[model samples]
Target: MASEELEYAGFWIRVWASVIDTLLLGIVVYPLLTAIYGDAYWEGANFVHGPLDFLISWVLPAVAVVAFWMARQATPGKMAIAARIVDANTGNNPSTGQLLIRYLGYFVSCIPLGLGIFWVAFDSRKQGWHDKMAGTVVVRKKSGTTRPVEFNA
Candidate 1:
């Protein structure tokens, strides 16, 4: 396990990253949803209004996000801010299982009035509940410092 103090990405940066990702997903998802549901797209706030809605809203994003995390160790949003996700203890790329758990953990983070996500703002390591659940962390490179791919935790 890595054994050193590292700079963890805090809540605001992560929130902004999430916004960017959400917007990007929206660009593709909204049009597809509109086409599938037509005028009834916004008829009600139901989550699973139809099969396509379930596929488009939930399945697709989960797949895309996990794929990005596996392939790049970060999503486009995380990359934009020079942040990457890694095992919390190892400071290396998280396992596929961990990535999946992290994705599901998002729901947990959001369900309870977003307290889990907000935890990042106060945690010493800047970890949210999803990060804690998946044993992962978001970190960025220190200015003028070049370290190995695996951070020193």
Candidate 2:
């Protein structure tokens, strides 16, 4: 088996990818919610209720679980960026239980005002707190071919 090493994704690329993913998710979800609840959903006293926060607290974790699980298992976003997530211990895709644990760890990372995301920017291994907790790493996918280089003398 090939050795799977963790690839440090540059901070900017990761930020951009996350922005794209969030926008895509919002584009799909917002319209679906609007359609289901109708324009009146945002009217009246109920509009100012705490349901949005309630929904978020519950839904966001679930979404993160599904997204990370799929990404780790199938390399979804990582595949798009020529990367992969693998278990640090085994150098293979993480198990479902590991993925769930990883997702749960996100809450911890977010506790101190999202220091986990910052950890990626400065950590020696570029592993976020969640990554460390889950024992997983993201690595660039290996390209089979090398490019020719020309040098000026």
Highest-scoring model, TM-score: 1
Q: Measured by TM-score, how close is model 1 to the native structure?
A: 0.87
lDDT of 2 at 41: 55
Q: lDDT (0-100) at residue 29 of candidate 2? A: 58
User: Any runs in candidate 2 off by more than 4 Å, and if so which?
Assistant: 4-6, 39-68, 71-76, 142-153
* Model 1 ranges with Cα > 4 A deviation: 1-6, 143-153
Native-referenced Cα lDDT, model 1? 0.84
* lDDT of residue 120 for candidate 2: 75
lDDT of every model, 2 decimals: 0.84, 0.61
Residue 146 CA error for candidate 1 (Å)?
A: 16
